[model samples]
Target: MNPTIKDVAKLANTSKSTVSRYLNGSPVKKETEEALKKAIKELNYHRNENARRLVRSKTQTIGIVVDSITNIFYPSIFRGIEEVAKEKGFNCVFYSMTSNKYKESYFQNLFFEGHVDGIIMISFSKRDKQELVEIAEAGFPAVVFGDSAGIPNIISVDVDNYYGIAELVRYLHRIGHEKIAYISGPEDAAATKCRLAGYLETIGQLGLKVNPSWIVTTDWSNEGGYHAMNQLLADGDFTAVVASNDETAIGALRAFQERGYHVPTNFSITGFDDITLASWVYPSLTTVKQPFMQMGMKAATELFRRMEHGEEYPSERHLLKPELIIRDSCRKISEPIATLK
Candidate 1:
């Protein structure tokens, strides 16, 4: 028969509660813990102590909700979360919303069904924000990424979207590109808004007029980028275009190539988020590097700290800086203009 907690307690000459306290690492005396460890090893006892503790407490599980699992960025983030969760002995359950309102709400309801100890939401819409406020108010631990609208007691992990894009814009300006266009992500996304602000600010600082027609908003998908680029190409002549993300940039690149437009020669293009595909693609896209894996690791670490300490970990708003990676995608406009003239 397998030895139980009681058997270990008996062997240690300690009460069940004392053994339990020691097992839980709850400030037991060193001598007592040593005795218990010896007793447990001698008896080869292994009890479902965690299960018993969970019956009276949380399940030690974390709920991760993301906009889309199909994206490479999300998978990298999930891998980071999984690594930290495993190290901390916590189980992680993931849900993909697929950017659908109904599915997002359904999963929100499921997460609230007491299966998880806390939640880490990758991105939330305005409507989702309202729902999440209610969830946080109800005393459930939750953290959101990319939106720092500041709800009470909710932690946020954000990127330096504005500065990142601003740097990209400056780089493009340095390359002598003045007639630039922007392909933006969904207007509803706070990150997208920040990026737009950066683009506009950079343009203004460089004494350039913002062409309203040059800015287009899309759904943050490859198709959206492709179509937006097509429309932009038809509407105007631009020396360069800044895409919201690598996926979109790559898509737009394919579209441009299909139409016999040589990247960096006919037009310069840049993207945000240096995803794996960005480097693999022809011309090797210039982009703003978001530390996706690090973001996930930070989020998971924060959640676990909250769980273990049983105290709010100073609800941080982490805005990590993004680096600009230069590549062949962007062209030097001055050189081309000089050659042409």
Candidate 2:
């Protein structure tokens, strides 16, 4: 028969309540503790009834809420969080909103109902942040990803998007490509604003003309990118295009190919977020490498730290640097063509 609290308490010659508190890691008398240990060993018990009870009494799992699971970025981030959570013996439960307001609210209620220990929210909007603030103010632990607005006790992890986009634009200008176009993500997104600021800053520094027609914003979807690219191509005379993400870039690439436009030869293309598929696509992609996994891992680790210590080690924003990866997709205008002597 499996060992029970009654069996151990009887063997230790102590009240069940005392044994229960002792096994649950509560303070106990030195003499009673020794008796419990001896009784547990004599019974060859490998588990703690009190520990099980404690676990059952509360939900010790973390919640991860993301905008969309279809995006490659979210999955990579999820993997990072999962790895760290597993190492720390914590379980992760994910809820995808698919950018729906109602679903987001539903999950927020789940957290409030004691279904999770804490949460890591990705790609939250202003309204989402407001709701999250309410939860945080109520003393719930959470770490928000990619929000620039500073909230007390709410940890954040994001990339240096402005700098990353600036670097890409500057690189294009350095290669003598002056007529550049950009396909931006949702205008309301903080990341989109930062990246657009980078592009504008670089254009100004290089004394390049800004064409309003060249800047386009759309949902970060393949079809959105494809349609946006087609519109940009028709409206402007651009030699290169900068997409908000690899998916958009790939979509643009497909549009170009379908229209018989050669990548890097006829036009230069660059994408943000060096997703796995970026390199797999034909002609490969030149993009900014966002450390999605590292960001997620750090977010989870930081949340756990806060939970364990009741306060974060340091309450500050962590902005990770993004690197630009050069590939065949972007062309340099300086290349010399063979001329007859």
Candidate 3:
């Protein structure tokens, strides 16, 4: 027996009208939305899309949900999505959630309500992933523009985080760096886990000893990078730091400069995500370039195909390549670098 809206309403302790408002993309209170989402998940409750689509019809619009608009990486990706949208004669409504879970729920509600024929999402959390999987399982047309490691149901278009980090590590080794440290993003992120695995695997292959203290954990923020670098300074010594992204790398650079360390002379740093700031910063950042625009294009293309072909359409997982952008951040060192015992 399939769950009904009444079951959802009952489990959430909210009125049927409130649940209707939520499903219809009407604004609901934050706590109410949370409760509804929880109830929906627990009960595996999905709205009657077939009946809804009979009334709404095709809108020829696709929704895009990005993690952050201000982050330099997304605009290029947006451009890519836009390009595909134009070619396919579709319109796009871009939404930036900015890490707010409730806001994400609001957008998901819009997606569920048949407002858009399809949707492309970027930077999903574990909770977001589960919800998205459920959404896809319900036969919604969707694409994720980030890691989709554990979930096979949802279509994903992502850069190769592991290969990118491996190339970065190999590049550092080639530049005569033996003692290296890594500043990682949140542990739960698939990108963080994959990049960390690459770093560990490559270093092991090269016979380099890893000091556990050298691997500092932080969020993917400049301030987090700055503080993590300071912690590294207090904890031990290393020749180079592999940052999770260009922002953190730049932040770490500032930290080292504040302590009067000359980049590449006394220390070296590298970053992933070759954002615009990477090249503009002093002693320009050596980083890995993720094909942001291509990822967007691929995601949008996959989404439209699924929308047109329905449930029988084959799912896809596109792993785009990452490029190593060499710059002035690193240097060849003759002396052996120090390490914490």
Which ranking of candidates, highest TM-score first?
Answer: 3, 2, 1
lDDT per residue (tens digit) for residues 223-277 in model 2 = 9889998999899999999998788899999899888888888889999988889
lDDT of all the models against the reference? 0.77, 0.78, 0.81
Worst 10-residue lDDT window for candidate 2 reads: 49-58
Rank order (by lDDT, best first): 3, 2, 1
RMSDs, each prediction? Answer: 10.8, 11.1, 9.0
Residue-level lDDT tens digits of model 3 in 226-297: 999999999977888899888889999999999988787789899999988999998999999998888888
Output the number of the lDDT-best candidate. 3
Q: Which pairs clash in model 1?
A: none
What does candidate 1's lDDT look like per residue over 1-341, in tens digits? 88877888888876665565455444344666788889999998776756455332456788898776565567778888889989978888987777545443355444334577777888734435566555444334567776856665567777789988899889999989898899998867678888999999999999988888899888877888889889898888788999988888988998898887888888999999888788989989999999888888888888776555432356667888898999989878876432322
In angstroms, the error of model 3 at 132 is 2.5
- Measured against the true structure, the TM-scores of the candidates, in listed sequence, are 0.73, 0.73, 0.77
lDDT computed for candidate 2: 0.78
Stretches of candidate 2 exceeding 4 Å from the true structure: 1-60, 96-114, 124-127, 148-153, 188-190, 311-314, 337-341
Q: Give the better candidate number (1 or 3) by TM-score.
A: 3
TM-score of 2: 0.73
Model 1 earns a TM-score of: 0.73
